[model samples]
Each structure stands twice: as C-alpha cells, then as structure tokens.
Target: SGAVHFTRNNLSAYIRSNVRYLVALLVAGFDPSSGPELHYIDPFGSSVPIRYGGHGSGINFCTPIFEEFYKPTLDKRTAYNIIQKCVAEIQKRLVINLRNFDVFVIGREGITKLDPINQVSLRAQLMGNPPPRK
Candidate 1:
C-alpha cells in the first residue's frame, strides 16, 4: 500500500525493527561471481543476493507471489514493478490492520523513496493508471 524512505545511516535500525516487529524474509537476486556485488543483511545476521531484495510482515504470503511473478534476472522495469507491487501489498496490510508501516528499497543505484507526498502518485503509476479518478 505504501513505501518508506530512510537514509543509509538508518538502514541498520530499520532492519532491526523489521526483524523485531514482523515476520521478515529477504528475497534477493544477485550474481555472486560478479566483482563487488551488493548484499542485504538483517538483524538475524543472514545475508544474500543484491540486485533485488525485500523484507517485512506478510512476506511469507507475498514472497511466493513474487517468486512466481519475478524473473531470474530483472531489467529495471521488472524490478520496479516487483518492488511497487510488494510495497502496495504491505500498504494494504497496514491499512487493514490500522497500523502505520513503512517500506524501503535498496539497490546499487541507492534508495528510492515514496513518502507521504508522492506515494499516492507513485502508487498510481505502479498500478498502470492515471492517478486516482479525482
């Protein structure tokens, strides 16, 4: 349903909270043989993949959906859609539970954020429609 934004310095804290507060899983895609690839790690001290990854509540429910939907290697378009869908699902859960939640996406290009102001616009784009029928 939405996305969260944070600076690199806060990444550790974010990972810690996600592990502590929710059932978290990391879905990553990477080529280890490549020189100097990136990796993601959580509070549990597990690290893997790089090109693409995510963690949060309902991850168990959503991951299989992603797996089936995701390609082994993704182009930018595929990666963007996958991430947008994942975040939208998280946002839906947060709204249904009346909980406030945030999501972060990290990559070699750095992080892209969808905070309060632009989330709606971004979501609209993700859904492949013009912004809501307002």
Candidate 2:
C-alpha cells in the first residue's frame, strides 16, 4: 500500500497496456525503496520477479536451462552468459532468422544498452557457420 506496491503495480500495468507489448521483457532497474529489482513481463500480461526468464519461440528451448541454473543472486557477468546461451539456443532451434539482439541493464545510474548480438555472431557461435575469435 506504499511506494513498493505502487511502483510495481504501475510498471506491470503500463507494460501490459502497451499496444505492441507482444514481446517478453527481462526488466531490471532500481526502485526508491527496494533498490535493484528484476522482473519478467510476458505477452500475456504476467509480470513476475525472476532470476531468469525468456519469451517467444526461445522460451521453449531455453527455459529448461534456466530452471536448472537460475539463481536469485546472479552476478553481472553470469547474467550476460545466461542471456547469450538463450540466444544461441533460440537461433539454433528456431527457423526464424534473428538479425540482431540488444541487451539492456538498468542499474543505479539508469538504463544502459550493454552490448548487442549480431547475426554474424550467432551464426558463428550456434550455427557452426564459422567461429569467431574467442
């Protein structure tokens, strides 16, 4: 009934209400009282706190991995690794060609785009087309 619920509820509702909110969001940011927080909002309007989540065709391929490995206190590097794995699995399993992907993180400062995944990289890593430098 205070700051926490208000902020959480507002975010959930806003996400659901958006016209093209057909995608899933792995959202992380800070709340005035709660500090750093993470949530997964799906196309179906369910917003949930989670250490890991995925959506669309990727969910079917990557959720089991998250189920086995997700931890509440994920370090920054580990979180990036998990996302990469999800991308790889999705690209490998799905026929759809994903051209690019963006990774965003919301921290004390604000939302920042960390790094991006490209088609070339995905093909190299997951499709066995050719390897990128490790």
Candidate 3:
C-alpha cells in the first residue's frame, strides 16, 4: 500500500483498470520551476487526495486510518512520512488479520516489494518483541 504523485502525465492504465472511479481529489500547484506536477492514486480503487493513498488486503481497515492521519496537503517530506506510517499500519493489520498477505508500494520512483521484509518485521512489530534491537 502506498501513494503516488504523477509527474506531467497521469497515465497509469494499471491503476485505472484496477481502481474503479479513480478521481483526482487534489493536485499540486504548478511550479514552472519544478519539472512536473503531481497526482495521487489508490491502486485498489478506494479514495484519493493530494498527499495520501494506499492499497492492500486490509485496505478497508487501513483506509480509515490513512484518512484520519493524512494531511489534506503535504510537502514532499510529509508525504514520505505519511507513506511510512501507512506501510507500518498495513503491515500491522496484515499480521493480525491474516496469515499471509503481500504488500507493495508504487510511486514515481517505482514499486518496492515488502512481503519479505514485512513477514519478518510484522511478526516482531505485532508479536510484541523488539526483534533483537539491531
């Protein structure tokens, strides 16, 4: 689960096909100084905003949390923070709600597969142990 900001073109057939009724709730201000504008997409066809979005198996549970915690507008730094927190929350929910669920994050930079790390980290994070503190 993650959020993506489109640059210049908001062309993502994968997102459009999978996420029904995709809408651009907010758009970053045009900065001629900056290279490209930004847009948000929720891959599972949920909801959208300027700075936040997510998709995963526990999306129903995660969406509310994201909405509550997400800022209406966010700078690059804030966007990254929101993303990290969302990922952590999804990882948490997945561990408790299901035995196995893969998590993926995609953005302008690209997608990062979290299943392997999630499997190990979620167990420690949710299971209530510090996981060696290393």
| CA lDDT scores, all candidates in order | 0.47, 0.66, 0.47
User: Model 1 Cα displacement at 129 (Å)?
Assistant: 4.7
lDDT of 2 by residue, 1-134 (tens): 23334545565676666544345566666877776776765555456677656557778988887887678777666776677777777777889988677877666777877567666665565665533322
User: Once superposed on the true structure, which residue ranges of model 1 sit more than 4 Å away at CA?
Assistant: 1-52, 95-119, 126-134
Q: How do all the candidates rank in terms of TM-score, highest first?
A: 2, 1, 3
Off by over 4 Å in 3: 1-51, 95-134
RMSD of every candidate to native, in Å, equals: 9.3, 5.8, 8.7
Model 2 alpha-carbon miss at residue 15, Å: 15
What ordering of candidates by lDDT runs from best to worst?
A: 2, 1, 3
Q: Model 3 misses residue 129 by how many Å?
A: 18
Please tell me which model should have the higher TM-score, number 1 or number 3: 1
TM-score of each: 0.43, 0.62, 0.34
lDDT of 3 by residue, 1-134 (tens): 12344321343554555544444343433444542344544433333434444334666666776687666455544544444455576656656644344444443555555433345554575676533321
Q: Which lDDT tens digits does candidate 1 get at residues 31-98?
A: 33442244554444444544444454566556766777776566545555565566566666654442
Worst 10 residues of 2 by lDDT: 125-134
Query: Between 1 and 3, whose lDDT is larger?
Result: 1
